[model samples]
Target: MTSTDAVPTTAPAPTEAPSSGIPDLWFELPPGFLEFDLEEDSEERMVRMADAVDPLFADATPEQKLSLVVSGEYILQTMIAGGAEHVSACLLRMSDGKLSQATLCVIIERPDVGPESQDRRGTARRTAVQWHEQHPDAEVALIMLPYGPSALCIRDQGLQLPGVLFGLDDPIPTTIRQVQFCVPLRTGPGSALFLFMTEDIEHWAEYLDVVSGIMKSVSADEPDGDSKPAADNPDAGGTESQA
Candidate 1:
């Protein structure tokens, strides 16, 4: 569940076109809220990366991709939503213990009509901006863990996942006592990058930064489906861990 265990395989051999979802290098400074400019030709990259995710991409049915948009939002309401329209529930790993927390949402979709859409990334960003206006009280940030990271780590690290990622084999938990939101983005000096509060903020950011970097590096190899992490990973957290 920790960063140490989430490292993806190293980069694949070079090829034509932007085969990798991540760029060649990522800086090692502030952690967590990873942001990057959207490439004009990013749709293919998005599909490629999404397609490479473990089971989701391997034998993914068209129906599943359309449904994984809000896996946990409906579940974590009272504990962590902090008054927002769209929320993401996460299992936070704090220095001491777990806590339930929620983060605002940014839903993106593909502009082009394809079974594998690329514009979903943009849809999410635009929605986030709109969400911020609707609820002036919530904190929001954009930190996209590469598809490989999201698919591989969310379950193993016990992080609560959105509907888009949940599966029938991955049954939803019936009850939950605690949750935590881990947002490692630092907006500015003394400012919260992810809008929620938690300890080890920068340290968490370091985790995201490093993870993002690694995924980006390995994104090109047409992600393989090695043995996934065991389910004992306990990947079910609440709103308390996301902002």
Candidate 2:
């Protein structure tokens, strides 16, 4: 395995808006948070990225192409916070000034492909195992989220923060590949997973608390007769939910 302090390069603007089912649109940014405007065609950018790395897609076996179908069809918008610069749609800093770094990446999976929640966990474990086999020196684990409903927690050995998976729809053939590649980035600290975070070992607890707040803010359903506005929802930082 190789490591580089390089940043992500920007891709051409996309022509279409990515589709998502999450209702809450607005989100409150933590202090020092930086927002990025994603160009359209996130999936296209990812395909191009894979080609750059492998280059022989046309001649690869069918299974190889399927494995490469990690990003699915839609990449969705992203909200990044912490001490780092944004590069293109899928890249970020390897490490942030010794401070913690976290990103909320929204992904859409069709109801057709992959396993459901319980099965998804098994798949995640397999992915982690494969990752370790490739990079033996790298640390990896398949843990459960501390709070919220039972969900698989994917984290690197020393990463203070781990990305969470929030599956909005039922498993379908179209969305089956969503689990193929959870994170958009193929290298660096955050890869093939959502909610990537890297921080000092001692700050792990602090980072978990911060990420929890962000997840609490996410709600796909309209605030029912009992629900409160997103901003009121501490997780959302007081922002409206977008359709």
Candidate 3:
């Protein structure tokens, strides 16, 4: 995808209604990603996570559990503060037995005007142009997805969160690179869904491919009970879920 070129496309397909209230769309995420339930309160979410990870932490001491829960709470608070409708973490075990992880956040946006007031394709093109104008160095391209047109932006140097988020006292902040795709949804006028992923630069290439595959798998309709998770499909990269 070039900086200013629109990738070739096939005809657009019809939009699907969101299965849930907050997220008007559904997509998938690769294995190792633990999706947080945004509707639940922090305490409830913590309990959920604890239960999910109980097997792994079955032998943990009281102090270890306390420290881990505190850290988890901080991360959850930050994600909620950023208006993330869907939040997930991809944790992998490195060769040396160390843990490596990345994060993906999805935020759904609704148009302010009436549905008839805006054109989906036009809005996507405008978004691409505006992003280029604001960040000339960042790579921007207009691409066609199965559902419709979208604006994809890649920035090597992305947002840096404060150290406090990780319970660090150092003045240096944590740096992360981001790949974002703004997909215009047909659900409403000027409505769009943004998929933002942040990861270490070393794993950028691998994660980019993963995110691209996830974007390609996005659909308006939720998957039926018979549908297989991405893990079961060798060609697919993520598990179907509402976001």
Candidate 4:
């Protein structure tokens, strides 16, 4: 497939962040990458991301799981509850051979609770919406949150999606198609990845391959190939969980 050795993962590495570089796990970047690092947990791999998802599938058999290493409350509190900070989001497309399944990913830093309180979730949605709008040729929705609870919510919601999300009252906490995964950030930040269009499941592997390619290219462009742990502070939080 075709790819470029450009751009970079946004979140900088914190003390607890891993330095192994792109991991050998199921998800990976492409081969032509010059520099890249893989941690056990990536923020772009969360659940709330699904809120941004649109009509990507008819019905998907979702998987169930949980990550208690760092409770969502704890992560949120540790970061946001502690004070103010910046968060980053990402947009990804799962290539389904001829068609493409688009997804949006996000990474929140010091996420106890940000200034965008009323529109906290909106912050992420807006970012994803803008990306899709800018690239109308691409798919819509499919949002992801690098935060922990968002990941938990991804699996929680993905399993009961489609019909269960009609009420405008609650407004579908997870409007996008999202999935939760473990990240290597301190306390291993939680991550969410939303998958728009259940039809893409038939071509999941191929689409994932495209994602892997992009990830590799991003890593290759990293200045150090990977983020190293901080010497002064061992539990320095999630610095590399950038984007």
Candidate 5:
């Protein structure tokens, strides 16, 4: 239940490694994006949530506070269930009480091969092809990010029930647009970062660019004192995302 700071337009600088031995991943998020760590325990998570929304609940009734806490827990659990290591959300108020939102989920994985030996272009192409197979209508492309070769996929995800997060009893279904990026990490063998962003279809283009900038800002510190931006080599051959 520690005090939380205001949401930053960019991520903070990397700190020392955690006690769990996992190195902190560094990345920036656009303005209005609030990020939550999905790896914390329930009590810690709840405390973090309370800290973030303290101003909103400062003068609210007990019942209202409970409802808000419950809704927040539900959203956290859903993200944890989906294997997200971290989640960030940007919500904009729209006319007629509607909301335009962009959500980003980060998932990290370690593979068998190291970054030096991995085939970046082939990896990017394979990822694109796999996603294309699963979503025939998706627009898949290989992109060269500052970090390295990466895959980008964009597609309409039909209707989704996001109202649950807002505590709506009978929320309307809204169409979702998704943009996913798979970028190989400089961290040893097959370490990669996956960014999955979902947004309201009406604001897909704007949000996609925001997420892309976020992706470009991602970097990791290596064990041998090397930095991600300088350690990994970027390929210039891949096509860029249309956004």
Candidate 6:
């Protein structure tokens, strides 16, 4: 579950687009977050990257182009924040030897809608209900964290998913616990970043604290020279096993 084991692959070939001269963003990671090296060639990686951009571009209106571009920037910055080529993830090992994971993503709202038009809490509760229905064996609850009102924190039990890039057949614990949080950027509609943490139920308080720290430490500033870069080897590593 540590960052040291990530096997990086060659960076994907950059696509040719109009050069607006806006340098790409690289977000700063909070202390103790481990970035899983996401291979560039994985199907899951491609799906995630596509998810970040595709939805924003679909059925586009002439005036929506600028919003789409800004939304894409938020998605890209979020990808960098979690140290992922496409989808970002950070794993933590708790004191009880249980594994905890945080999967990060960005969701861009449609351009025509006002940010306040949507009901975040109601939507989040419905999401929680859907997750519970998907995993009947797990306990589920909607929660509020210190990360402010725009954040959605959902606690669930017995539902363990592998890393974002790990395929369906990847070995994982038969049972798992997770806390998923979605925090909308203050930039209004077409911008929000989220993180989900999976860990043992016993470590609920601890994981909550960890996510809180992450929310507090997140920044869009460029990383320092001393900051660690994403994993660069080309090997596919196994997911961290649950203890």
What RMSD does each model have against the real structure?
A: 17.8, 16.3, 10.3, 17.4, 6.8, 17.0
Full ranking by TM-score: 3, 5, 6, 2, 4, 1
Summarize candidate 2's per-residue lDDT along 1-243 as a digit string, tens digits. Answer: 011322222221111113432322222233323234445365675565555434332444544433333322222222322222232222112233332233344433223332222243344456567866765655455533311111224345421111122232433222111111232110111122334343234455555554444444333233242333322222222222321
List TM-score per model, in order.
0.23, 0.33, 0.68, 0.28, 0.66, 0.41
Report the number of clashing residue pairs per model: 36, 22, 1, 60, 3, 1
* Model 2 stretches astray by more than 4 angstroms: 1-29, 40-118, 146-192, 195-209, 215-243
Give the distance in Å from residue 182's predicted Cα in candidate 6 to where it truly belongs.
Answer: 3.7
At residue 85, give the lDDT of candidate 4: 27
Stretches of candidate 1 exceeding 4 Å from the true structure = 1-118, 148-243
The TM-score of candidate 2 is 0.33
For TM-score, candidate 1 versus 5, the one ahead is 5
Which 10-residue window of candidate 1 scores lowest in summed lDDT?
184-193
Q: What tens-digit string does per-residue lDDT give for candidate 1 at 41-104? A: 3455334433433232333344433322233223323323342222222223333432222222
Best by TM-score: 3
Candidate 4 lDDT over residue span 1-243, tens digit each: 422321233343222113443421112223221111222133433343232222232132222111111122122333333331212222233343233223323232334542323232343455455655655544444323222111122211232222222333442222223332222222222222322122235454554555433332321123445543322323222213222
How far residue 20's Cα lies from its native spot in candidate 6, in Å, is 8.2
- Of the two candidates 4 and 6, the one with more favorable TM-score, higher being better, is 6
lDDT, residue 24, model 5: 43
State candidate 3's TM-score: 0.68
Scored against the true structure, residue 47 in model 2 reaches a CA lDDT of 61
Model 2, residue 107: C-alpha shift (Å): 4.9
Task: Point out the worst 10-residue segment of candidate 2 by lDDT.
Answer: 183-192
Model 1 sits at a Cα RMSD from the real structure of: 17.8
Clashes of 2: 22
Residue 228 error for model 3, in Å? 20
